[model samples]
Structures are given as structure tokens and as C-alpha cells.
Target chain A: MIAENYSLTGKQILHFETFGFLVRRNVFSAEEVAKINGEFDRRRASILAEIDPEEKRTFTQWPTRNPENPFTASLLDDPRIYVPSEQLVGEDSIPIQSHCNSYGKSSGWHVDTFDRRLCVIKNILYLQPTTADRGALRVIPGSHRSPLSEDLRNMDLYGFHDDTSPFLNASGMRGEDIPCYIFESEPGDVITFNELTWHAAFGGYKDRRSLSYNFFTNPKADDEIESMKKIVEHTPANTQGLGTVGLEYHPNWLENADNNPRRARWINWLEKWGFTDVLNN
Target chain B: MSMLTEQQITFFNTFGFIILRKVFSDEELAIMDDEFETSLKTIQGERPDNEVPKHFNWSNLGPETPFLSLLPEDPRICETAEQLFGEHVIAVSSNSNRRVGNTHWHTDQSHPHSYGLKFAAYLQPLNSDNGAFRVIPGSHKQPFNDKLKHIEMHSSEITVPYYSCDSAPGDIVIFNFATWHSSFGGSTNRRMCTIDFYKNPETPEEVEGTYDQVIVDEKVYAKLRAYGSGFHPHWLANPQNSPRRQRWIDWLRKYGFVKSEEA
Candidate 1:
């Protein structure tokens, strides 16, 4: 059994650093997963109700720091989340965002961000079992590093206009046929990857449920801080324009920060870096 | 003629492997299969009980099997190797195998500086459950290559992710030597042939890497000798008189792997 305050072992850290990702099986108990699933369903139902019937069915909600869902918000404080983030990034690393998504389409192969300066890690939890033929996450190992990363960027993997992607042109295979490691997962498995790693999903059913908890290793350099700013400024606008105009965190999240040392420390860092102002409110 | 497109080159560089479907026609596959079977029979006949060993292997380069011997120099194979490793690439060796059971995850070239490739053609239809070749893409590149060392030890567990190169008789699968690859769930006597090639050394480090590979190949050749097989005289003498083949022969001779008597 994993301890309550579990930290990543040296081997696990090496694996993540080397392969650009790591998987921890059964990190959460069935009871904990059920709680998370319950929160996701409740929030998803509310978000779906607001959308037009003919609009795309995908729904995403920023649930991490939402005061209305204290159980979901408290996940940032959970050791299973924080400890690995701290170990991989640093102790000063702060929770950046948490998203609950019910995906309606398959994701094309791409990295979360192209900004190599940003040291962000995303920990993903799928609410159901998935395989390669299902909706399992696939990654090209070590694509985040130099040379390979630059090579992929030059290929413009994301810029293909028609059916002819560079992957297809070169390998005589379709996008889904590109060689990659598929993260076949069970409900309690936590798969963590660097933001720069190339990943995709295919053949997923509509309303595929997943939760992503993202963390940013505290920016120490000027360029990294600038990258962070761009991320903070653009995230809300990119997420189908949801949430308050200028606020990254909910007001209740900021209000509760006073009572939580971990959240307070992160809030203070965000304020110092002037990132909290990006959302205006 | 250059056989690979720019996009295919980029894909191979990025993923460490690529598949070319129908590289050989059905008739060509049939002829090659016949040649391979005849060679296997020749080796089996020399054995004490006329029995082919599990995972039986023999050199593909011999005058007795004219078609199999010329595969390394075939334009489809040689030109593609040139496109990947430049015009100076040399055919290292070609061997046919009758494999059984499963082969575990490992790289052919593990040295950090060494670079090489293999062209694999399976003689039967295969898929994920039945001996399809599998690879961890991008694992040929460093940090990833070294990171996968643990796989060699815990191969059965195989925590790392991989792609299966499902193939048919006429398909060709090419992969970097540094890429971690393996096969599983194969029936007994799974027939396949492979031709190895190495990037011609242009630097001192690459030269050293070439020497390192020679050491590895020496061990393999010693095993082949025990199995009553070795490089054919026609192959050693380079009867085709190809300059690229000559360069490789010279290098092998310099390392004492090929001697005057053998030629």
C-alpha cells in the first residue's frame, strides 16, 4: 500500500525525466475515485445545461480551486497529487489549473505547449478503463527533448490541412498509425507527463471523462516567467471562453487561501509574479 | 535511385523506424522464401540428426543462394539505407533466421556513438498477438536509449510503451540499431530475414563505435561458426565488385574479422 504522504522513488523520477512521463497504478482507492467521479458528473451536468443543444457536446470545467466543490478543490492539497508534482518540479511548484473534461472527439497528436521554457507537468486521471483501441493516451517517448523536438516542430505535425500529415507522407501510415506508447489505464491510475511531450488519443467514445491537474514549476528565470504569463493570459480565452473575465482562480479559492498554508504560499507566489492580475478581476 | 521521400526520412529520424508496404512483389517474396528454405535445408542436412535448431540462423550471403545474397545490394534496400545514413553507408551483414517462442527487448547497437539499421522482412502474416515486431519509438535517441536499459532486465514486465509493426509477406520494416525492439507470441520456426547496415564512420568517435560493433559481431560470428555456418567465399571476395561492399570488406579485414585465407 502507498503511504498517506507518499513521495516518488528515485527510479520513478528517473523514468519520468527520461521517458517524459510516468504512470502510477492504483494511486487512489476506489472510494476516492468514486468521489472524484461524483464531483465530475455533478459539474459536467451543470455545464452541459448551459450549452446550446446543437453546439459541440464537449464540456470542460475548472474545478481545482472552485469553492463550490471543496472535495475536488482539496485534490491539490492531496499528497498523491502534490508530492509527485513537488518531486518532479520542485517544492515551490504550484497548482496552475485543474480541468474536468468530457471529451466529445479524439485529440490529434500535439504537445500541450511548445514553449520549452515552461516547466509544467500535467497529471491525468481517466474515470474509466481505456486501451489503445479505445481512448488510451499515446505518447512518442523523449519527443520533448532537443533535436527530436525540433525535428517534430519542423514537420508541422499540427498544421496539416487535408488528410496528408507529415506522419502519413513519410511513413505511409495514418496519424493514428504513428508509432507511440499507449498509456492503457484503469480508473485509479495516475499518469503524469511533461507539458512538452507529444501525445494524442483516438477512437474514444463521446463523453469520455478525464480530469487533468496541472502544475507549474515556479519560474526562476525571466523567460520562464514570461512564458508563464502568456499561459495564464491565454488559458481562459482558449477554454471556450469560460470562467470570470480576468480571474484564473475562483474568488472563493482566494478567500479560502488564508486558511490553507499550501494554497496561501502558491497565491503569494502568483501575486509576486503578477500573474494573478492577468484575468483582471 | 533515391527510394525514400523527404517526409519518410523525417519520419524515420523522428520515430526510429518506418514500414514500407509491398516493397517486394508476391512473386519476389515467393522466390526469396524458396531461397531461404533451401538454405535452411542445406544447414539442417549438415547437422548430425538433420534437425533444424530452434532459432536456427545462417548467413544470407552465399553464392549457393544468388537471390538472397544480393538482397543487401538491391536498390530497394541499399538506396533506402543510403537515404537514411547518406551515400557512404555500408552493408554490414545479412542473416536469415527460423525463430521460435519470443525475443526479449534489447538494442542491437547499445553504444552511445554507434549508429546502424536493420531491414526486416517476415515471411508470413503477423500481428500484435503473433510475433509482430515491436519498438519503443524515439527510444533510439539518447536519454531515452539509456533510460530503457531497465527493459533488458525486466522484459517480461515491460512497463514501457511500444508499437507493434504488424506486417505481411512483402512488407519491409526498417529500424535504427539503437531502438529497443522485441517479438512475442511467435509460433515455432517463424521465418524472417534481416540485412544490417551501418553509417560509414566520418569521425573518430564513429570509428571507435564501429570498432565496438566489430566486437559484438565477432561474438555473433563465433556462434555462427559453431552452427556450421560462416560468411561465404563469394561474399568475402566481393564477386559483384561493388565499391561500397569493398569498403566494408576492407574494414572487416582491418579488424581481423576477415582474413586472406577466408577470402
Candidate 2:
């Protein structure tokens, strides 16, 4: 089953390490995409009302907790991508923040592996067709291998400053303007990129949404199978009804018994994914 | 010398933060300035194809106008980073932009991360009017939502005419990768240079290139997955994003200096 549908191709792996991105076509069905989008709107309405835009900077980023109801089921049911995940991360990979992103939407960019020496991958499943007219995703091709500064890669991490003047342009995007490109698909266009690859939000209107999930593997885990087994236990049983939850789990859980090679790589990925508080938590 | 000494390392350990004063030299500043001049022009609106306009330009006037470079041709900057971070250090991200003309403000951790630090240096002496570096000490422990719900309901559009903020040029400011800060674009010309770094707390800062060797925990993976992709917040350029105190005042909380109940 693992070899049949999910395995990283040499070309894809190269793309991931060099540019920081890769693509998978038709990873989701149209109906599923529409279903998730509908639920997103329903929850977003209430979430948006809670915030007074003029006076707040941080919202509870991801929804606190939820179950696998119709909305969540739709959110998590991306058949095409999960199978592909086995190839990129490992044979037994599962969505890390499946419930939380539904509430937050829009993952910002940061260098994968935290630096060039580290290796990591980012996965994007267009549970829905994200078009430029509807906010297609944008990314800097080959950014992972660029001769640029780390700050340059993370420029958008703090936030995208819409301070571009009609007369003057905002600076700092080094590659092509379209480095950030739309993930073209019907519903399940699962694209994977280098974790360090520079990408951004593609511009579009409502329903231009997508589902993103990242996974990691210890390149040399003594017991990769055992560690993955523990992950399932940590997850809430019947994860059928949880909203997107950020800081899903903390680090340190895999220390000592796991050693650094594989275990250390897992922790490194955490820092790049924007879970800055992981260690502290 | 309120610099990032051994005690600062302990503070970073307990609270997850550290501060380093003007650790950069004048020559580094000049190189950063020259790079900013070139880099800014590279990502301008002229590049219609590029979608992520997450960086800015302006060496003549602005704080940290030039993005930080880990692979900068200038060996001094890299060597300094190596000295501080140890051989295992990696360039997480860098930026070059003009801060508030008089008072721009915001922290390093706009985006959440697993474990990292924001280390920066002022390339030019900043005019206090333009923007000086100041931090909220140990605010990293607080869980500020990515939504910025606690900040005032100001959009990312406010600028010069409506408000004022400033800073000093040569004075270096290095806060935690998670610390919150802001700067005002001074009316007078100002130039600032800085770079942010990320290292595994468990790994020695001096370890050479430790990025891919370690796998980011699934917790980190899941967080990014849930927060959406690196593109949702779209926080690139804008003066409205002044740092913390203004956020406190705008939020109208009981104490701007003290942590709140929600925090």
C-alpha cells in the first residue's frame, strides 16, 4: 500500500530541497472542497465577530477544540494527499494540525529546518481550488537553495505589510514576483515544497481556501514505528470533531529515549512551523 | 552593560528570551546598507510575477531597511553570528525595510515557531526620532494569538500623517526571536540594519548548520498545519503595526507594562 501510491520521487525530493516546494495533482474532490469551504464560512462568521479589528493583534489563532462532525470530517477527508504524505514524510504519517487550521486558515512562511543545513518539507492539499481570483497560494521557487539571508526568507513571517505605495513598491521579495503561485487543481491538488522555500498567500476571493498539513520523520529513528505509534495515543480519540488547534502538542515528549538524529530533526521542524512556544509549553 | 551575557542565556532558558546590545561594528553597517540598496530594488513592484511582497526597501531612511543575510558575502556578519550562535547556527530568516518614519514598532515573532531567537544589529546610528529599540523584557511567555486580537482594532493601513514614531540609527537592538518590538519612521533620515536567528535550545548555538539534521517535532508540524500556511496573515509592510505599548494603549487595558489576566 505504501509503495503503490505514496513514495517520494528523486525529482520531487530534489525540488523540495532546492526550491522548497513540490506539486501533487488532484488530491481532493470538488464536493469535499465545497463541503469544507461551507463549514469554514459558518465558523468564520462567529470567529470574526469576536474580534474588534481596531483593537486586537492576536486572536486565538486556531479554534480551541472540536470533533469530527460534518465540517471536520470534510476538513480532514483529503484522500489523495494523505497517501502521498507517506512518500514525503514516512509510511505512517498523519495530519499534525488537522483540526486547528480550519479555524486559523493561512499558514505564514518560515525557513524549513530552521537553517540551510536542516532538511524539511511543507505539504499543501487544495481541498478546494485556490485560484488567483480567489486567493491562490504564492511561493518563491528554489528559495531553499538561494544565496540570501535568513531574515529575507522570514520577511513575511512577522506579517505581510500592505504598505506598497501606488507610486512606490514594497521591497524584499527577491525571486520572481510570481514566486508565490496558485496551486492549480479541482479539489485535491496536493503540492509539497521545501520547508524553507519562500511562499505566500495567493490573492483571491471567498471559497478560495485550501487545507495544509505538515509531517516529519526521523531520517534515522531507531524506532520510527514506535514513535509514530505514540503519536496516535497523544491524539484525541476519534478526532472527528476538533476545530483547528494550534500548539497541538509540545516538544520534550520525544527527548532522551529518542536521541538526536531522527528525534532532533523532528524538534527542528517544530521551530520552523511557527510553534515558537513548543519548547516552553 | 544590559547585553546578552551568561545571565541573559539563563533568562532565555527560563523565559525563552535574551537581548544583545550594539554587538555590530560600523563596517558591517555599511555592508548591510549597500545590500539593502541592491536587495530592495530586486523585489520592487516591477517584479509582477512574484506574489509574496513580504519585504521592503530604503537605506537612506528607515530602520532595518535592508533584510538580514546569513549567507552575506561579508564574512564579518557570518563570523559574528557563528561566534554567538556557535557552529550549529543557521539563518532562519532575514529582512530589509524602512521602519516607522518616526516611530515604527512590532516584535520579532510575528509568526509563531517551535524554538528560535531574533538577533539583530543596527547598521547605522538611528535618530531617536526615527526609531530606537526597546523590548517588553520577558513577554515571550505570553501567548499572543496570531490573530493579534489583543491589539487595537487598527488595520494594517495607518501611517505617518495620523501618528508619529522614531528611532536611533547606529544603536543596535537584538531581541528574542519571540520578543515584541516596534519602531517609528523618523521624519529625519535614518538607516538601520538587522538579522534574526533561530537555533534549537537543546543544540549548541555554536554547532555549524543544524537545520535539516533535526526534524521539527510533529507539534511544530501540526501548529503550522492548523495556523494555515505561511501566507494567511499577509503581514509584509505597514506602519500600523507599531510594537507593544501602543498595542496595550490601543487595546485599552488596565496595565500596559504588566501582563494581563488573559495573558
Candidate 3:
């Protein structure tokens, strides 16, 4: 069992530093897991209400900071998640995106665009048991670090238009044939990985639920600041025209975390990025 | 005298691996078989289990077996290594394996420098139905290989066509360590062995990679502890030495991999 403070062990850090990903089994208590699932479903029903349950659908970047769903918002500051993020990126890091996916078919293999100047990571919390056959998160170990990782960034497999390319079809290789770690997860298990890591999902069910929080280092360098600008403007709907989430935090959710210094830092970071109008206030 | 043909080398470069037909003669095969059987006896005597161990390697067979030890020096092997790598190629490791079940598709290691390769010889005649080797062509190349990781992860769910190497006992299959390869439909008693070699490091990065591979990595050390002694004492004493072999051995000793009788 992880300690109460839940600092990463040296071996865990080594694995992450080498492999670009790590899994913490049973990071949440059973009750917390249930509450998290309840919060996700509660919010999911409100947003995807018009869509038929039978029809396949995917909606990303859902706001988890609803006052009624405090569990989801508190997850951002949870020691189990925050400690590792601090260790990976920097202590001054801020959570950038929170997204929940309901169901989707096989997603293509890709990385979430990496910046050479910054370290970005994604923390995934599955709401249900998932296996390799059922759209489990698959990652290539050490694919984010060096030689091969750069190759992945420049590959033209999917092509400019995301059209099917000859590289994939010529050999009859599918999304699953790629060598990677099949992260079969149960609810409450947390899988944290570098944003640059190559990953994909295949054969997902309709009700398969999971939440993701993307975090990046606080911008210091000029290139890093520019990269951060592009990230905030292009990703979240607040600063950017096309993307997910209008506000980084909900007013009710911010009320609960008003005194917390981490939350203050997060808000300050957002404001510095010209996202002042996005505050829930 | 028996070196890889131009076509064979092209095939290897294009497909990331190749199978040379009957690289070893029948007499050599018999000697290899004997040496292998004797090694199996020694290993079993050490660790007896009813069910075969999932996977275990017997390293440094050259020290234990007379003929097997000389395999790296064989004209066919030496010439091929020279052509592919350079005059400074070094044979680093030799080992036999008792394999079980499926080895999922994976590159051996992501090397920072030049490629390291494994020359494999299967003891039994095998086809795709019974533990034959398989590989994806061009998957070892930079951008092309990057996409293979995702495909390999989902191989069970997706039908990714791969080259199945159906072979007999005398054939030699050589492949880059970065190439994605796996054995499927293997029996509980599947037997195979490999002699690993690498091009001499010329650059600082390559030198560091060489050091990391032999001295720094724990996994590499495990294999070394089992099979990585300096050249066999007999070979050292009665050197049927070639300039090439001696240079390579000298390099290994220089790197502190080889232990002398004095030490």
C-alpha cells in the first residue's frame, strides 16, 4: 500500500524516467472510487443527454468542478495525483485540461504534441475495469525519451489529412499490432505518463468511462512561454475559440479551494495567460 | 569462404531480418546438436523442474564446448559481420535458450548508436504452426518503427501480417536488436540459441552506448555473469588467432569485460 503522503519510490521514479509512464494500482479507496464514478456519470448524463445510449459517442474536456461533484474537483489537488505531477513537471505546475470520455471506437496512435522546452504529463483515472481487448490505454515504454521518441514525432503514418496511408495497409497491420504496454486498469487505479509518449486505444465499449487531467510545467523560458500560449489558446475554450472547457475552475469548486496555495498558483498562472475572463467567480 | 550474398544483405536491410539457408553443414549441425544436448544436461542437473522453465539461456557456450566456441570465428559468420558492420565487428555474446509460449513483438533495446544484432539457430525443424519466428519488414527504420509499437500492442485484436521464418536446423537467422520479432505457437520444449555481435564503436556516443550495454546495464551483466567470460582459457592458451579476432578480444579486455587467470 502507498503511504499516506504517497511520494513516489526511487524505483517508481526510475521506471517513469526510463519508460515515460507508470501505474499506481488502487490509488483511491473503494468509497472514493464509487463517488468518482458517480460524479462522472452525473455530469456525463447532463452533457450527453441528447445522444442515444446505443449510439457510439465521445465528448472530451468535460468540466469536473461542479459544486455537486466535489470529488472530481478535489482530484486535481489529491496527494495521490498532485505529488507525482510535482515530481515530474515542477512544483509550480498547473493542471491544464480535465476531460472525461464516455465511449469511442479504436482511436488512432499518436502523441499529444510535445514541447522540447517543457515537460507535460497526463494522469488517467479509469472509472471501470478495462482490459487490452476493451480499449485499454497502450503505451510504448521509453518512446517519449530519446532516439525513437523523436522519430515518432516526425512519422507520416497517418498522413497530413489523417487519411489511411500505405505504410499501415501495405503490411495489413492494425492499430493493435504496434508494440506497447497494454495498461489494463480498474477503477481507482491511476496511470500517469509523459505527454509525448506514443499511445492509443482499441476496441472500446460504449460505457467505458475514464477521466484525464493534463499538466504542464509553469512557463519560464521564452520558448516554453510561447508553447504554453499555444497550448492554452488551442486547447481550452476559454482563451481559444475551438476546444474544450470554458472555465478552468467552477465558482463553487474554487470556493472550496480558495485558501489552498496550489489553487492560488493555478489561478495566477491562468490569469498570466490572459484567461482572466474564464474564472468562475 | 561462405559470405552473405548481395541479395541476402539487401533482404536483411529491407526486412530487418533474414534467414540464410543451410549456413551450417550437416557435420557442424551434428557437433552443435551434441554440444547443445550436453549443455542441456548440465543445466538440468543444476536446476531440475518437471515443467520446463519459462525461458532460460545458457551463456558463453564457447568456453564449455570446443566447436561451439569457434562459431563466431566461422568464415560464414565472420565475413557476414565484416560486410554488414565493418572490419572492427565484435562478437559479444553466445547463448542457448529453452523457450515457452509466445514472445510478444518487441525490439530488444533502443540503442543510442549503431545496431546490435543476434544470429539465431534453431535446433529443430519448425514452421509457423509450431513456434516459427516472425518479423515486420522495415519496422526497424526510424519513423517506420515508431508506429510498430502501437500495432504490436494490439496484435491479438488486429490481424497484422508478419513475415514468418519457417526453417530447418542448419539455417541461420540474423536480425537487428531494434527489429520487432516474436515466436508464436512455440512448444514447451522449443530450443534455440544465439550469438550476438555489434559493430565497433567509433564515436563518443557509440563508445558510451557500448559501455552502457556491457558494463552499465544490469540485464547485460546478468548475461555476462552467465556467459561473458573473456575468451575461453583454451582459446587464450592455444590461440588459432586471426588479427580480427585478436583485435576484438583485446577491445573486450580493454573494456574490463574479460578476466585473466591472474585476476
Candidate 4:
């Protein structure tokens, strides 16, 4: 159902970047998809190795457990997703957040901070069926173009955290704060939204089991894996998963959110390119 | 070469601008900088402020010549200009500002038409701390008919992210005539050389206006006139004396660009 309406224009593909969210008509094959699911187990093993014995139990929710993930290697081989993203984002757009997870698991609705100035064009492949009642993806569509917020409630759907918050500041993100596009999907569906999109995930159908994750445009063809590893190490590790990749620090725990200017820049870029609009709409 | 590729050319047509890097090489830049610096001395007395050290401007500098001669005879620049303007194009005014100052958002037609460059070719490196030329990319194609509102350093309402050439020295950036842009010289010092590159009026109607007055496409013309003088600043009564301005009427008369005005 998600694949029926999304299409990209030449100019839009070339320059119209929405909060770094981009859609690829098709990103994987049944076989390739299966392989990705296979990689999930491999990655889980790695995560297990990395996790401390005491925290290993907590790592069960980690996104890497799905090896047959379309969100990772499958899209790289599929040019449909990679080409447009490559064109819109500089040649440097690459897979930074490559893993698979379900709606109930995807954490946080804040903006991404990899290239703080980069409007995140995420290509997410839905390996499983999705439905709104099951808590599919939620987004603040059109909020990409909204002006930077002066207050958190005024900051659109992502909620506000004034300067005092340890992890995020409400006054940070720039552009419209409109709320729209909480995606409910069907299997084989792919979705992309702006970087500034205000979204959160919740309990979906107990049966909703799918693979999903984000990758960016890497024009330089630089090692996307290397960059993510570095980003993970360099940034304050205590941030929420998305914030850990750089937008806001662990907003769940910290009082003051990281209102870094770079974060705002990413938000602005999302709106400029039109990712805030629901692709089907 | 103009860093803008073919796809970029099309994107600029729609978005208004594109930012790229390293148009000029280090070797070529040294020569160009020295030539630009040397020309600055010739106009030294022409500028009133001796202390305004980094402030250099195009119309003031002279050898009574087009600044193009100063650029190293390189094929890359020529190739770039050819892609944008086509075969033989003239060199427009070359303005080099010495101080860290900003120009309000405006257009080029405000001044008497420029010489060699129709599109402005800019070069500089900018981060938030330093000033970078800001532009409203497609605003050139369509005017903001909405009320003219004062904007902060960055405003999405009236302006948008342009293809800014935020680069270090030796990098050459180019944008077309229809593009809207502004300069910055805030707390940071901005040393930049801006030269306009225009498509020859003799070539043809660039495109029909989107509605508007005059010969250009009505849509674009309306947008152009919408900015009214916003795009072009007003010239004082004493045209020959204003150091900041070019002697347009006089220059037009010399070049026979003007037949006569409706007095």
C-alpha cells in the first residue's frame, strides 16, 4: 500500500530534500531480503560480544538482530533507492543507520544529527506488514518547513525541552511544527520522512513483525559503516538511539536536551526539500 | 572548472542556486589574487577611507580594463562560462571588498547594467562565524509579491538556502542573473571578489516571464519589478561622484547603449 503513491521529481530528486527522508520504489528481493534477515542474527552476535555481560539481557531489543534486513545491504545494491538519495544529498549520502527493527521498538521522534546540516533522507524498507492500530510510523509532515521554535510546545509534535533539559532543548529545531503523516503500512512497503519530522513509535499489532532501518546518501562513496562507527564513538554515548547518532542526547533521561546548532540545521534542511509531505499524499 | 555539473545546471534553474567547491586551483588563485591586489592600489586614492584596509570594489579599480585579463588563461573557467553563457561572453564588473561588511538582500540590475559578467561569480569560504553570501535561489525567477518584510540573518519566509559557494580562497562560485543574493561582513572579516556574468541580451529572450512588464518573460519581469528597487539600490543624483556606484548614464552614452530617455 505504501508503494502505490510515492514518486520523486527530477528537480525534487536533485535538490528537494525533505528532512533527509527519501523513498525508493523497491529496495530488495525475496532472496536478498532473506539474506538481510540472516545478517540480523550475525549482527546480534556482534552486539552480544560488544555488550557487557550484565547488560547483555538489555540488548535483546537491539535493531541488529534481523540479518535479512532490507534497511541495510539490500538497498545499497538496489539503485532505485540509492540513486535519488545520492543525487539529493551530496554524493556523500551513505548508510549510517543500517539495521532492522519493528514499530514498537524504533525509539524517539526527534531529528537526526549525523551531518547536522544534512537533511536526513532515510530509505526505510518495511519487511513486515504494518498498520496504524499496530503503531506504525508517526511523523509531523509539513513541519519540515516550519520556522524554528521558540518554545517546546511551539516546537511542533516532537515536544519541547527548554534550554534546561539535559538532552534536548525545545528551542532548537527550525521550521514549521505542523503534525501529519503517521504512516501505517502493509508488508513490502517502504517509507521515508523528513529529518525534522516529529514521530514516535508505540505498541503495534502483536503480529506486526517486520524489518526496518535508515541509510543516508553517501556521495563521496565514503565508508558509511566507518562513519557510523565514528559517529557512535565521538558523540556522547548516553543519547537516545537517534540522538546517539547525534540529534538530541538521551532526552528520556537528561533534563536539558542538546540544543546544538547543528541539530537545528538538519531540521531546516528536511523542510527545504519537502520530506515533510506524506509520499502517498 | 565551474563545479556545477550538467544536472546541477538544471537544478539551479529550479532551485535558484547550487553550492560547490574548488573552482579555481591554488596556482591560479595566487596569480589572480596578486593581480586583484595590485589593481587595488591603483584605486587606493579613489576610495576615501585609507583605514578601510580590506575594502576593495570593482568599479573603483582600474587599468580602464575588463578584469578577465587578470584571470589565468585557463580552459576550465572558459569551459564553465561556456556551459552557462555560451561561446564568447564579456567580463562584467569585478568588486573586491576589503572589510567585513554585508550587503542587504538585493539584485544586480539595481546598478547600471554590469559589464563582462551577467551571472555573479563569487569565491569565499564561510561557516556561521564568518559571513557567507546568502541567496534566495528561485526568487529571481518569481518575485515575492508579498509585502517586503525585514528578515533576520536567516529567514525561510523571504529567503531560502542558495547554492552558496562556502569555500576557502581560490574557490570560484557562480550564480545566474535571476538569482537573489546578499553578502555578509559581520563579526567575522569577509574578503571576497564578486564579478557578474550575464547572458548577452543579444543572445535571445532567456525565458518568458511566469507575468510582468517589459521585454523579459512577464512572470520573471513582474518578479524582477516586484523587488522594484529592492533588487537594485537607488543611485544618487550625482552619478559621476558616487564611489560606490558606476557612472551608468555616462557609461551608457560612451558605449552608445542608450539612444535617449523620455525626458
List all candidate RMSDs to the true structure: 3.3, 22.5, 9.8, 20.3
Candidate 3: tens digits of C-alpha lDDT, residues B1-263? 53865545654665567777788889988988888888878766665463346776766435567777778777778778777777778887667777778887888755647568889999999887888888755567665566555442553323343557789999988888878778888998888778878878899988777777765434644643333443555655436657766776687777655655513
| A61-97 per-residue lDDT for model 3 (tens digits) | 4556556567787788778888988888888887866
TM-score of chain A taken by itself, candidate 3: 0.87
DockQ of each: 0.53, 0.01, 0.08, 0.01
What would the per-residue lDDT of candidate 2 be over residues B1-263, giving only the tens digit for each residue? 22234433443433233334444456755666677656455545446664322223322212333334222212443444444555444443344444335433454443344334554455554433445554333334433222122333232321111111122333444445554445544434334444444443353432222322123322332332211221111222213553322332232222121124313
Q: After superposition, how far is residue B167 of candidate 3 from its true place, in Å?
A: 14
Instruction: Compose the digit string of candidate 2's lDDT tens values, residues A1-281.
Output: 21345555565554444335566565455765576666666655555566533423232224312332245433333334554555666653434453324312343433434344323455665545566444456664434443322324333332332333111133333222222334545665666765665555534333334445565553345465454444444434323233233234433333424363433453455444433343123
What fraction of the reference structure's interface contacts does model 2 contain? 0.00
* TM-score winner: 1
C-alpha lDDT of all candidate models, in order: 0.79, 0.41, 0.70, 0.41
Interface RMSD for every prediction, one decimal? 3.1, 20.2, 10.5, 16.4
| Residue-wise C-alpha lDDT for candidate 4, range A1-281, written one tens digit per residue | 22432235643442233222333333455665566556655654554466533432322433331223324533433455545555555544543343444222333345554243334556566655445445555553223443321122232324222223322333232222122244555545566655554455444432234443344443233465455345445433332433211121112212213453433443343333322221101
Using Cα atoms with residue i matched to residue i, what is each candidate's TM-score against the true structure? 0.88, 0.35, 0.62, 0.37
Worst 10 residues of 2 chain A by lDDT: A160-169
Q: lDDT tens string, model 4, B36-133? A: 56655655655477334434344322333324333312354444555666554533333454555666666544322321323233444564335665
Q: How do all the candidates rank in terms of DockQ, highest first?
A: 1, 3, 2, 4
**Winner by DockQ between candidate 4 and candidate 3:** 3
Off by over 4 Å in 4: A1-281, B1-4, B46-56, B59-75, B85-90, B109-124, B143-164, B185-189, B202-263
Candidate 1 residue B253 C-alpha distance from true site, Å: 4.6
